[model samples]
Target: MTEAAACGIDGVDTGLADPPLLVADGVTRWYGHRLGCRDVSFRLWPGEVLGIVGESGSGKTTLLDCLSGRLTPSDGTVTYRTAGGETVDIFSRPEAERRLLQRTEWGIVRQNPRDGLRMGVSAGANIGERLMAAGGRHYGRIRALAGEWLERVEIDHDRLDDRPTTFSGGMQQRLQIARNLVTHPRLVFMDEPTGSLDVSVQARLLDLLRGLVARFGLAAVIVTHDLAVARLLAHRLMVMQQGAVVESGLTDQVLDDPQHPYTQLLVSSVLQA
Candidate 1:
């Protein structure tokens, strides 16, 4: 193989040979003197989904923000391993590099669609914005990509030009998923992606998410207050309480026989179909 070909994924140039996609070592985030994830450490690999479940105020969102580079850890390192196998600490990176990764590679979806989306913009534009940041500005490419993601997320492509205001809470959440997934990110951080939707809508969206996540082979960190969400989408589950991971294991084991009291309570709350 040619030197260039050797460095690429089917000539696509994905840097997966070295460094975890995102890594947190003793990472901690603070909110007005409150500790979040005190000395938290974990590694997220490509194509793996790690579920973070905790009650409110358990620091799930704080950990996601720290890993996504939106919040700098108070006393730890957030490292990003590049496509070329260079590892740079996210908090310590120069502003330019950090901005590039934040805009291009990382995808974050929040509990409230309004918080994550541009309500004034059309759904297509919202999805296209990420592509524009990733250096795709040509109208055709952006629209085509947006349409594809819209369909992928089960949104009707015909509504591409419609503003988010026309959609229901479920549709808005689906649009947000499309917006984030359109970037083809390697790691996605979703904070309660379906929290606002009805149970029926949540089930459909959850199924769509599972398929899309597998099809793209993307790694994810999902935070949810719903135990069922953790059971549905996670390969591994990390149960947290008061800013610390108390129990972690394969999702089935963790759900089937939760050893931790907190985990037991969490699992017990789930209702069978």
Candidate 2:
């Protein structure tokens, strides 16, 4: 198939006709002489999850950062179709405007719980912060919503007042997820959301994430090195090698019948491991 057909640029059948919620066009980022990611482009529609998979240093995380607006790409644009139906260039928007967008319409789940959660604050406060950002003003309502979110994440309501630092790694990660999703952000950017956990913990977290994502009908861009996690959560997959997308397709297709040599090796290695 041609590149255009593979990337869905020529309106390849994606099973859904809805317009894309996000578009990354020719996005490239460089760190001095080294390439972080190069000429990456894709469209993500509402209620879909796109997984980026690659080995360490393959630039999947860097591409995610650029897509999430945490890093500025040296070239190209990241356009988002907002909840208000405005297609805006995220990078070109003012920093304050971008920050507001992140706080209100976008959610980011960092690989490290410490990066995503407020370690010093109570779990309820962490969740409440997001609600407040979404213009929620009633103190009682905010706390109530936070408690509800805690339960939704499978945490005990009694632990709502506990600081994140006091929670276990898995619990803290769950709390971070609760904080990010309390406001029901339309788009979520996740970087190795289950990467730092034990095998059992990773399974639980991934299951919870899958459920919450489906329940909320969220559009997500997830970066993960674990093929298992990608298969569990991603509807579509993109494989990167040395800062470039080498293959992409439905998750099952990419894993079962990878077309690219690098992608074949990746799948084989994962299965063998």
Candidate 3:
């Protein structure tokens, strides 16, 4: 397909069309002389999950940072179309613009629970703060919403006032997910949402995430080193090696019949390990 066709950028909104929620064009990020990743590009459809998988240092996190406008791309643009039908290049926007998007339209769940969550705050406060930041400040509404999100992630509401320090690693992660989801963003970016939990915890959280993504109609980019995580969560998969996408396809096709040697190695590693 042509670039314009792939971008869905040629007057295609048509009022009845579903516009792409996000676009990254030739997006690249680097540290000094070394390229973190370059010539990277992708688009996200609303209500879909696109998984990014690669070995460590393959730039999965870096690419996500760039695409989510968390890290400024050394080259190229990260464009986003708001639900209001206004399009803006996130990187090109001022800090205030980015903040507006972060507070309202975009949510990111980081790999480290500590990094993703407010470790100093109570569980209810953590999720409630996000709703407040998104312009919801009613104490009753915030508390009720926090309870709803806690329940959504299967957290016991009785412990809502307890600090994250009091929770297990998996519960903390669930709090982070709740914090992000309460805002009802059109897109969410998750970096290893299940990375730190044990097998049992991971299984439960993965199941929650699968159901949550569908329930919320959230478009998502999930970054992970675990192929199984990608397999369980992604409808589409993008494989990276040495900071470049080596392959992308439907998750089942790429995982079941890897065409790239690097992808084959990834699949083999999962199988052999």
Ranking by TM-score: 2, 3, 1
Give me candidate 1's TM-score against the actual structure.
0.89
Error of 2 at 243 (Å): 0.3
- Candidate 1 deviation (Cα RMSD): 7.4
Per candidate, the number of residue pairs that clash is 0, 0, 0
Ranking by lDDT: 2, 3, 1
In model 2, pairs of residues that clash are none
1 or 3, which is superior by lDDT? 3
Q: Which candidate model has the greater TM-score, 1 or 3?
A: 3
Candidate 2 achieves a global lDDT of: 0.92
Model 2 over residues 88-204: C-alpha lDDT tens digits?
A: 999999999899989999999999999998788999999998898889999999999999999999999999898998999999999999999988999999999999999999989
Give lDDT tens digits, candidate 1, residues 122-185: 9999998888988886999899989988888778889999999999999999898888888788
Worst 10 residues of 2 by lDDT: 1-10
The TM-score that candidate 3 achieves is 0.93
- Report the CA-based lDDT of candidate 1 relative to the real structure: 0.85
RMSD from true fold, candidate 3: 3.3
Identify the leading candidate in terms of lDDT. Answer: 2
